[model samples]
Target: MENIDKRNRLDEAPFQYRINKDQTVFIDYEGKQVKILKGKEAEKFIKNVNAAENDKAVQLIMAKITGNFKRGNERKKR
Candidate 1:
């Protein structure tokens, strides 16, 4: 398997998730809320996140879940 940590910088791990009391999951990117998952989807996401071996794995999971977050023409912030 490819090493995700190498492809993406550790400081650039922008994905974050929070589980609500109602069993819903809120996924965030760069401190912005991007996705909300509930029911079976939420459960599965939780399982996958919990099973992730490292931060990079979790970041990959969130990126896949959130679809394409980048547009080729966008410039990086300094």
Candidate 2:
């Protein structure tokens, strides 16, 4: 989890979401400018998110999490 700044007071504020003129989904989460989707990138993001919850994918992802998931070890070809 990320640490929230005290002065921002975003810990108590509700999130605000809006779409930009270019159809980009912008989120104001905890006083942070987080983008959820933009232009053609939404399709890929939605695909991965939906895949994460699939029955077969869930099992396979859990297997990796319990076995191969690690920190600072990305890009290690296997």
Candidate 3:
């Protein structure tokens, strides 16, 4: 079997976040909302995201906030 280049898939960032006027943070994955942060948590999340050095860093932060997603048992959508 040939070695497949899976780096492209890892380069794709599926996580996104938005902050509301009331300082609530909304975390989304693949265009769907998954987590919400309010009050102190929202403030801390904003600070961390802003301090992230790159897209990959931001993705990592979002992934942790949204809980474990890389269990290796996820099936690819056809």
Q: What's the TM-score of each model vs. the native? A: 0.81, 0.30, 0.79
Clashing pairs in 1: none
Question: Any residue pairs clashing in model 2, and if so which?
Answer: none
lDDT of each: 0.84, 0.44, 0.79
| Candidate 2 TM-score versus the reference | 0.30
Q: Which candidate gets the maximum lDDT versus the true structure?
A: 1
Better of 1 and 3 by lDDT: 1
lDDT of 2 by residue, 1-71 (tens): 02323243233443444556766655444455544666576544335436765444433322232333234
Winner by TM-score between candidate 3 and candidate 1: 1
Candidate 1 residue 9 Cα shift, in angstroms, is 4.9
TM-score of 3: 0.79
Point to the candidate with the largest TM-score.
1
Question: Per-residue lDDT for 34-77 in model 3, tens only?
Answer: 99999999999999989989777787778778887656678766
Q: What is the C-alpha RMSD of each candidate to the true structure, in Å?
A: 2.3, 13.9, 5.2
Sort order, lDDT high to low: 1, 3, 2
The clash number for model 2 is: 0
Residue-wise lDDT of candidate 1 within 53-74, one digit each (tens)?
9887888888889887665577
- Candidate 1 overall lDDT versus native: 0.84
